[model samples]
Target: MWQQKKANRRMSGGAMNSGKWKEDELIQQMLRIAVPIALQFFMLACVSATDAVMLGFVDQTALSSVSLAGQIQFVLNLFVSGIAIGCGIMIAQYWGKNDPKSIEQLMPVALYANVLFGGVFTLLALLLPEQLMRIFAKDAALISGGAAYLRAVALSYLFCGISQVYLTLLKNTERVLLSSKISSVAVVLNILLNAILIFGFLGFPAMGITGAAIATVFARAVELIWAYLAVKQERTGI
Candidate 1:
């Protein structure tokens, strides 16, 4: 009986190892999963560069406004990203346990929590954008423009929160490639829309500070749609 149990254990281990034996295949899979993610993050970072370039071309005020607004958004993002990391930990542990239902159950609570926290944060940004700007000791043009820009893009926390949570869910589910694709699509949409809206190209209204807000909202929407589609396709199923 002892020998039989040992043989069973060895066979089980061999079966597991056999399925994972193709080192090249594993490497390819890792690259497929990792490259897109790296690219997506790079793309997101590029958006900031793009924003600075385009706004600077418009005028110094446009550049300053967007830059200041970005500062407030950045601080809020730190908190939201922290929450996302915690959610990731929860999702990863549950996923390892093969509990999709738990993931589904936990996601809404996490999302709603982000929403609640983000909403309050947005309120503070809206109500006291100028005060926050003054704290930065920016020049007059930047302080006023930044205040205006923050007011215009005040919903940033909500938009970012929604996008961040969904992406985190995908990551924990091991759908990193798909998540990256979604992010890439959103970045493209954002850049295109920014050009059109900011420049009034094709007769679109040149919204200026408001244009940046619109682009952000549109990009988040695209990201959310792609994430939902991925979830519907069961790509994240273990």
Candidate 2:
């Protein structure tokens, strides 16, 4: 009986060890999933910081223009993020159920919703930029400069609509690292283009705040294209 009890204790110890190993593995997997998502958002925040810092070198008015103009994007992001989060929850559920076809069907719905929201904001920004700027600032320079920024960046709203949905899908589908890479590459390009186009480096014309807006537009466009390519490669199609 004592021998049998000793063997049982040994088995219990082994079980504990196995459980501990699994716990460690679970933690590692969670980190693998979380770190890239965190990094993507970090890089995204850096874009705005880069713009503020770089434009500050030009003048206070330029600095203020980009800063205030960014508010429009910020508000739109709230709506986009809400949609993306809802879609992520649904996709994760579908993935858990092993329902790929349902996910495929859902993708187009989310994409259209995002694009629709983005289009509305694009039109508003394009057609009523000065009025939109006035909602944030009363100064004439701010209204005029930020209006230019808004109009130039209006197209990016549509592009981001597409990219952000894909990115959220990527996260849900366990491809968060790729999502991070796409955002990071686009951010780097944006920062580089901001410097080049703002000051006309490498023979590029100095476009001031307009250059900053264009940089964002170009970066969002690249991000959308990259996400689309990733979707194609991964077969995450609608």
**Which stretches in model 1 have alpha-carbon errors above 4 Å?**
1-26, 232-238
lDDT of each: 0.81, 0.92
The candidate scoring highest on lDDT is: 2
Model 2: what TM-score?
0.98
Error of 1 at 114 (Å): 1.4
The 10 consecutive residues of candidate 2 with the worst lDDT sum are 229-238
lDDT for model 1, please: 0.81
Residue-pair clashes per candidate, as listed?
0, 0
- Displacement of the residue 95 alpha carbon in candidate 1, Å: 1.7
Query: Clashes in model 2: which pairs?
Result: none
Q: Per-residue alpha-carbon lDDT of model 2 for 1-238, expressed as tens digits?
A: 9999999999999999999999999999999988988888898889888898889888999999889988999999998999999999999999889898999999999999999999999999999999999999999989999999999999999999889999888889888888889999999999999999888999999998999999999999999999998988999766
State the weakest 10-residue window (summed lDDT) of model 1.
229-238
